[model samples]
Target: MVNFSLEGKIALVTGASYGIGFALAKGFAEAGATIVFNDINQELVNKGLAAYEAEGIKAHGYICDVTDEDAVNALVAQIEKEVGVIDILVNNAGIIKRIPMIEMSAKDFRQVIDIDLNGPFIVSKAVIPSMIKKGHGKIINICSMMSELGRETVSAYAAAKGGLKMLTRNIASEYGEYNIQCNGLGPGYIETPQTAPIRTPGHPFNEFIISKTPAARWGTPEDLMGPAVFLASDASNFVNGHVLYVDGGILAYIGKQPK
Candidate 1:
């Protein structure tokens, strides 16, 4: 039998209070891995814990910022003490600013880069040591379609995600010998709370996304569950430094001809 089970694994997903991260963490729990998550503050952590509990999963939650190296280190230590050495890490914490490039301040750009790019770097560094000792590890960075394609008003996000793609590859290259696999999960046009407004019927962005996507609809958070599980499990042991784009085939298709 192909071994896809994570019966004795521990998974830590950053910013799993809701949305894609929550869905992925829940999937891990369903796969029999012990689930741990973190948020930036106590409030969000509490909320995430409650949400996980609501799903009948006793997820361990903590308050930590992935951008802070010391905090991330401490968080890993605490998880190791409380739950177990992390077997899987999902770098799902990120933020995006929608201001046009020209109008956007450098401070704002750096903030996005710090959170989206640097956060993963910090967290991954913290966990790799334990993983090295354990002889195997899986790190999944939640990259975006912006990692490959550019768009208007999201200069910083695109740049950070682009950097993250390279970071994912570099980690795999440097750590593959240690039996570690680093990969990226690229989500495209997901329908989340943040995107709910734009998805309203007849919205230009919605129409644009639909037309661009061969699937003809925005992807749901649930759509990523299987991919998340695969990347986290032994199933993808040989798959390293790859960015699996769950974009409903948008990247491959050009678009329908304008009527």
Candidate 2:
């Protein structure tokens, strides 16, 4: 039987205080992996802890900004000492600036790139040595649809995600010899609390998305569970440098014809 279980493994998912990160970490827990996560601050970490506790999962939570290289390295060291050497690293922490390209400030652009692009590089770097020593690892970068397609008000987000896609492939190329599989999980427009307003009936953006997507709806956090687990487990042992887009068929379609 093909094994999909993550028994006896340690998974570290970044920015898992809420949203997609929290959901993916929860999935790892369900798959029998020891869950460890981090956030940029204590409050978010506390919230994440409570959320995981509510689900009856005993997750290890920490406060560390993925954008801070020193903090990420220290966080990895602490987790190795406190939990175990991370067997799976999920570079899920990210940010977006929805300003138009011409109107967006250089500072804003750099901030998004710093967290979304540089952050993954830092966290992944910190964990790879341990993975190398252990002789196996899985690194999942939370890429976005913007990695392939661009939008009007998401100049920086698109650029960062695009770079992340390449980074994902490069890591797999560099580390596959050590049994490390690096991949990207690109989530489509997900309906979270932050997007609740725009998802209301008759919202132009929501309608536009529904019309564009073949699945005709926003993706749920639950939709990412299986894909995340698969990539983190032995099920995908031979799969490396791939971007699995759990986008409800949006990327496969060109949208409906005009009315």
Ten-residue stretch with the least lDDT total in model 2: 91-100
lDDT of 2 by residue, 128-181 (tens): 999999999999999999999988999999999999999999999999999999
For model 2, what is the alpha-carbon lDDT of residue 67? 87
Segments in model 1 whose C-alpha atoms lie over 4 Å from true places: none
Question: Judged by lDDT against the true structure, how good is candidate 1?
Answer: 0.96
TM-scores of the candidates in the order shown: 0.99, 0.99
Report the C-alpha lDDT of model 1 over 149-256, residue by residue, as the tens digit.
999999999999999999999999999999999999999899899899999999999999999999999999889999999999999999999999999999999889
Score candidate 2 by lDDT. 0.94
Top of the candidates by lDDT:
1
**Candidate 2 all-Cα RMSD:** 0.7
RMSD of each: 0.7, 0.7
Which stretches of model 2 miss by more than 4 angstroms? Answer: none
